[model samples]
Target: MVSKQFQFSCACGALLAAERRLAGRQGKCQGCGAVFEIPQPGVLSTAPRADAIAVQEVCGICQTAIAEDDPRTLCQACDLPYHAECWVENLGCAAYGCSQVNVLKVGPDIRIPSPASPLPGSRQPGFPQAGQSPLGASGYQGGALPSAVDRAAASPTLAWDYLWMGASAVGVFLSILSYGGPSAVTGLAALVAYAFQQDKSHWGPAATSLLLSAVGVVFGLRLSLLFWQAT
Candidate 1:
C-alpha cells in the first residue's frame, strides 16, 4: 500500500510535510520557533512540491561550495542541502522564506502522536494568557500614566529657548542703563546656543528668540555709541 503525505507551509516560508494523520495538530517551526497547526492535505491549496526542486552545490547559509563528499542534511521540505555545521548553526532549513527545522528523517510515521494525546495550542511568547493583563488579571485602573520623557517634554521648565530670549531682553535693558557689553555678550551666547540646539529645540520659538536677541544687541549698541560720543 502506498502511504499518503500531507504538506503545508509556515507563514515564514518553511514547507512542512507529514503523514495525513498529523493534520490539525500543532507543531513548532524549528527555524523561527513559530507554532502552527498542521492542516489536512485538502485544507491547503495544492502547489508544486518544494522537495522536487534540485539543490545547488553551495550551502545556502554560508554560500560556500559543497564538496560532493561533504556531509550535509537536505531539507525534506525544500530539498536544499547545507553543510552539516551550517544546518546545525542555522537550526533549520536555510532556503529563502523557509525556517523549518532540519530533519534527519522524512517518512510519514516518524513523528506522530497517538489520538489520545491532547493537541497543543499556539501562543505568543511573551503575551499573557486569556483574561490576564500585564499589570494583573484585573488590568490597570489607576489611569494611563505618561512616560517620563513625555512629562519632561510637556514641562514649562523645558522652554529653554523662551528662557534664553527673556534673558537677552533683560541684558538689553541693562545695557541701555549701563553700556553695550551686557547686550552684546547675551546676544552672542544666545545665537551660539541657538545654532547648536536649534535642531532639537522648538523651531518656531527658537527662531523668534534668536530674532529678539539680535534686535536687542543692535539697539543696545546704537544707544551706547550715542552715549559714548557725548562723553
Candidate 2:
C-alpha cells in the first residue's frame, strides 16, 4: 500500500510535506529552518501529487518545470512553488514585496498581557515606577546610572599597561647601552599594547603608552645615528 503524504506551509511561508504516519510530528523546514508541527490528516488541505501536475507547475526561482518526486516547497505568502534547493538558495519567497522575502523564520504571534493597575494605596516594593523620584524612596540621588561607554572609559588601567611602559623604558635604557636594536623591538611591543588597549576601550592608557614609546623610539634613532656617524 502506498503511504499518503500531506502538504502544509511553514510559518516562514515554505511549503512542506510529510507522510501520513508523521502527522502531528514536529518537522523542520529545509528552506527556512523553521520548526513546526505537521498537520494531521484532514486538517490541512492536501494538494495533488507533483507528478500529476508537473506539466503546469514550475519552480518560481528557476522557472523550470518541477519534476515528479523532486523535493519542493511553496511560498505561503504568495503561494508560489519552488524546488526545495531553489527556495533555500533564494533565502525566502522570490515574489517582490512578499512578507516572507528573506525571512528565515517567523516567530509565533504572541499577545502580551498588559500590567494590571495597582489598587489604590497598595505599594509594590521594588524600583521606583515612572515619574517617581528615585532619590525620594530609594535614596539613589546620584542621578542616572553610568552608561556602558562611561563605565568603559572609567575602567582602571590593566596590567598590560605597566608591562608596555616598562618594556619601552627598558628599550630606551638598552638603546643608550647598545645601538638601538632593542628599542625598535620595544617600539613594536608598545604599538601592539596600544592596539590591544584601544580595542578594550582603555583610551587613556593606550595613548600614554604610545606617546612614551614614540619618545623612546626617537631617542634610540638619534643615538643610532650618532653611533654610526662616529664609526
Candidate 3:
C-alpha cells in the first residue's frame, strides 16, 4: 500500500518529503542546506496535486511524460515540471508567463536568520560606535570638519619666522666679516618680524628666531667697533 505523504519544495527546486504530523514545522533539506517550513497536509487524492505533483508528470517543454524514477527539474516560480534533459535543452523555466532565465542550483534558500545576527544599520562588528567620526577623534563635530581648518589654512605669513631666522644667520656671518651697518639692520628687522609672530600660535619658531636675532645684533655691533678701532 502506498503511504500517505506531504510534499513541498525549496527555493532551489529540491523536493522535500514530510510527515502529515510535522506540517507547519521548520526543517532543513537533505539535498540542499535550505531551511524551509513544512507545508500543511492536503486531502488525499489518487491523482497528483496540480502544483505539487511528483516526478511522474509530462515535461512542459518536450511534452513527454516521465516515469516516477526518471530525473526531472521543476520551476520554483511556477511549480511546472520538466524532464532534466528537456530542462537543459530549453535553457530555463518552461512555464507560461514566467521569465526566470537561470535554473537554480540546489543550495541554501528561504533562510531564516538566527536571533543573534546583527540587524541592518546597527553598529557592525569592529566598526566605530555612533557619534564618532572616522577621520579623527577631534577637530570635527557631528561628522563635519571643524571651522578651525579654514581659519588656520596655509598662509604666507606663517613662513615669515623661517625666512627671518635665515636672514639673521646671514647677517651674523656678514657682521663677523666687519660689514656692520647693513648686517646689524637686517638682524634688528628679523627681531621685529619674530616679535609680531610671538602673539600667534607659532610661538616655538618665533621664540627661537627672537633669541638668535638678538645675539646676531650684539655680535654685529661689537665686530663693527673692533674693526673701526683697528682702522
Alpha-carbon RMSD to native, per candidate: 23.8, 18.7, 20.8
TM-score of each: 0.29, 0.27, 0.27
Candidates' C-alpha lDDT:
0.52, 0.53, 0.51
Quote model 1's TM-score. 0.29
Off by over 4 Å in 2: 1-157, 197-199, 228-231
Best by lDDT: 2
Q: Provide the global lDDT of candidate 1 against the true structure.
A: 0.52
Which tens-of-lDDT digit does each residue in 40-119 have in candidate 3? 87664444454653323446776555556788887777766678887787777876578654454443675778965543
Model 3: residue 154 alpha-carbon error in angstroms: 7.5
Over 40-127, each residue of candidate 2 has an lDDT whose tens digit, in order, gives: 7654334544632111245667766556678998788877668889998888888889987887644456555555543222231211
Worst ten in a row by lDDT for model 1: 121-130
Per-residue error for 76 in candidate 2, Å, reads 67
